[model samples]
Target: MRNSTIDLLKVLASQIIVIHHLLLYTPMSPVLQAEWPALLGLIADEGRYMVQIFLVIGGFLAAQSLLGLLGKARDVAVWPLFKKRYLRLAKPFWVAIAVAVLLGWLSSKIAMHSEISDLPTLAQLLAHVFLLHDIVGVEALSAGVWYVAIDLQLYAVLVLIAWASQKTGQLKFLEPAHALLLLASAMALASLWMWNRNAEHDEWAWYFFGAYGLGVVAHWAQRESKIVLSSLLIACVLGIAMWIEWRERLLLTGVTALLLMNSAQIERFVTLIVQGPVRWLGDISYSVFLIHYGVLVFASSVVIALGLTSVAEMLLAFVATWVVSVAAGWVLHRVVDR
Candidate 1:
């Protein structure tokens, strides 16, 4: 069952991320930055952090679908779940990479925007194909692909933890499922308090697991009996997380989790306002996220080649890029993702 609220958040977050990338990488952005410095800076810099919304939503849905409430844990087929996740992510992702490689090469022929164009070596291609580009120290072929790899890693860890807990005997102080939940929460807290603070470790799943785990806890909160326990768990970890070192991203994560936990009960008027476009955008969002950068690279390179320098030209270029990227993403979804 598709929750209109989840779809709404997904669409909003994905669009912001798309705009954020355009502001960051388009050759035209620097031209306009002089005129609208604050607007461009906020969208380009602060907007990238909207990704925490995606992480939270992904974790919530994963737990709701795969694990269910602890007392009634779903008997998921572990290997098949992982397989479905990989194939679902890989199909669109590999297609996007191919498009990126083609555009990257074509951009090299036209013009190379310093940040937008990077010709891929064989090693880089291999690294990206295996979703190990970050660990392999190969520059990414597309913007935000690292999140795809990290999402998969986080899902695998959650699945394994749930699966392993089922096999173990109950611990002295807890039921087996409770023990499992405790273990997962501990890892999340450790990540929030320790690994997430280090910029060097951003490539790893542990660095983002806290936000993801909050999503899981939020889904578990839906049942009346579990609400207090789940909310307390969230407060304790995120509270400590804030105490350790405050981050706007962590705060956003908390807000997103709380909203998701109560999304089903949102007032009807709000749904009427957002449901239509949000659902449509949500349907194509994965495609939008995967394919937008490739389109941007090609579009920005064209803008550079044409030597379009005016503020008017930059605005036109930015609008054109947004329209084309969304159109391409919609097509990609229809042709490949379905």
Candidate 2:
């Protein structure tokens, strides 16, 4: 069964990201901005932070799936894991890229805008196909595609770490699982202290490993006998990291990790708040994230073509875009992701 709390976070973050992109890329936003600058500004400024929720949760779920609470490296067939993850992310991603390209071409015929990508070259297309667009310095065809690439990289890193732990498991004092946790914790500290502090590293998984590693640690902590100590150590390390240099994203990651450590409470809380629609949205969140940008670009282009400027007209257009994005996401989930 799916964890309801993780699903809740996914639903909320995915919607916020969709709205954030809408406000960022849509011409209708300027009209709404005139009417409600504060609201628009708030979403534009803070909504990006929702990514931290996904980073933490990705780490949590990856750890749970790959290592389990016991940290057992049952089948560290790294190549198979990597192939499965890449295919899972890339299949829907390729479809979304097609959607983005088609809508971008159509939108250009109506009204040219910077949000629409230029026609991709063969090299750029290949880069995206291999999830190497960021590493190879090619611009993405769709918004938020970088996260998909980074997610794959992070999983590879985790799998490699698990494999290494298995190879070194002959030590009498430390089992492979314990060693895996220690290695992950060490990497997390390095990320939190060094790599994450630099903006230049943002394109890579190492920069985000602190948050991801926190999720891994939180998962293992639940099964450890020294859960309280583990939790305290995590908080103390994060506290020191913040004390050295304050980052709101890191703070959010820390909070997410702490909540995930007590996920039973969170699951209970979300059960009270999450209904059928929310659960459904959460199930299709990946589809929504992939397809919404294309839908938004198309909707905005139509609004621009119609010269929609009135506040009511703009508001209606924005609502229609959101609804259409959700509907498109549902279709993509059914046809591609399912």
Candidate 3:
């Protein structure tokens, strides 16, 4: 039940991340960093919204999938469930961390002060080790770790709901839609409180939780009726209007709703467009998201070594990064993921 639309959305979101990282180095041109670094920084500034989209989609799918499983399993056995998820995630994760380290080492000569470490300090290393660098006040880690954290949090929520669903007679006590609404409502209230309290941490929780809940609602929507065309139109309109705010990037949310409503119906056309390398990118996309920044670090150094000094060279660095990321994914799939 792989929806090509979801796969397509995943691939596109990964590219948005790439664009954000690319904006960071736009000032490496020396001239640009001096003359218009502020302007160059704008594109990447939107990276926050881009990351939000990823979080929402990941949250949405994780909840929908796990809840469905829980309804079927009818047990509170968390270990086996945890194991399956752990294997699927950690293998590719560790490989990416290793790659990030190597990149840090190779690019030491020209890296930003924070990244120029043969052995990153205790705090720095631990931040990355736990993917809590940004959370716990260490900003030296790469950008991709945030989504992993969000996914982990949502997974915890999903597992609990699944267990509850089973105990309650699998929708007899409280259906999935009611569960999603309750969760979404709780998250929204928490978000409001956080905003009022001047909390300075992880302001994107509402979007992530809402998206995950939407995903759950979408799953149920398909059973009631078909609404793909209507869902797409609304998602597009809302996504466009809220283009400026993280709270408003519900565009993909709508898309996710439509696809879930018509998962099988859309599969045929989606498969045609999503074929070839597009499908392949989705395979390695997890790796790309995890390690692209670190790969770019080494790539910057290599270009500096060859005395290449053009925007085009920077573009080539992106290519080099994908090569390493793709290879890293291959190794992880074989050794760690298995």
Candidate 4:
């Protein structure tokens, strides 16, 4: 069966993130508040957490997929594997960066209603182009680029972790119980280190490398061993703790769910929800992630052009943004994802 739960989580996470962006277009500034802004802040903050969920899923799938490839191949070359992973992440990434930069630059100069300063400048753009900005704690050129950097890092981390596992005879032993404990200890120490570091920075790094690695650990644990509740608990606690800052909270949430092993409640609900148009959105979720902001900015401009300043027009602008952007994303995905 498909990983329906993860699919549902991906869809849910994207919607939460998009809605969060929608809120920013309005005057409901949740992050500016001291006390929690209840649903608004929670929902808006979901962009980060949802991305973490994506990371966790990506890490597990990437590693598992690579392992399968290696198992089937007699003499696996590292360069090809690395290149494959890089292309998978980097191709759409290249398009996304170019488009985001162009849109941000254009909106900054030409578009009347826009928020392009949030995007990177030339120097920052270079850092992002090289995929090294987040490494040195530099901000992204675009709003959501740190995640890109993190995804790349997690790719390398997964490779190293898998390599080490095979070399150390851990993969051969398949005594998942022992591996689970060792991983648990490692994650605990990492969490402690993060807690000691700046929470904000730690949040970003953890989401990038730490959380995804933890997911890899979980997938390995589940596949190689019977079942373990401890990993889930750890991921859960970390996720709840992450609500204060990083998006890795959502990754931790995925890990928590994965640890549950079997849950009818989640399985049935997820299957039902991911039906029809919702699943169609899942197919175009990448569009929602990449072009939604650009579409929203343009749609706002269109509303202004039409001289339709009503609340209904604002709502229409938002809906039209998703519709148009999703179509563009589908066409773009076909061309660029190759």
Predicted model with the maximum TM-score: 2
TM-score of each: 0.92, 0.96, 0.76, 0.75
Best by lDDT: 2
Poorly placed runs, candidate 2 (over 4 Å):
69-73, 225-227
Clashes of each: 0, 0, 0, 1
lDDT of each: 0.82, 0.87, 0.59, 0.57
Could you tell which candidate, 2 or 4, scores higher by lDDT? 2
* Model 4 worst lDDT window (10 residues): 26-35
Which candidate model has the greater TM-score, 3 or 4?
3
User: Model 3: runs farther than 4 Å from truth?
Assistant: 26-43, 109-118, 122-127, 170-199, 203-207, 223-248, 311-319, 322-335
1-338 in candidate 1: lDDT tens per residue?
56767888888889999999998888888888888999888988899888999999988888776555345745646799888998888888989999988887888788887755566788988887778999878878899999999998899888887777665634445554555566677887888999998979988899999988888778767744476667667777788888989887898898888888877777464478566666778899999999999899888889989999999999999999998888888988998998
Q: Residue 204, candidate 1: how far off, in angstroms? A: 1.5
Let me know the TM-score candidate 2 reaches against the reference structure: 0.96
For model 2, residues 212-308, the per-residue Cα lDDT tens digits are 9999998887656456787798889999899889987887888888777777656777787778899899989999999999998888789988988
| Residues 244-331, model 4: lDDT tens digits | 5554454455554363333233677677777877776676666557656665555555555566645555556656665676776666
CA error at residue 332 for candidate 4, angstroms: 2.2
Cand. 2 Cα-lDDT: 0.87
Global Cα lDDT for candidate 3: 0.59
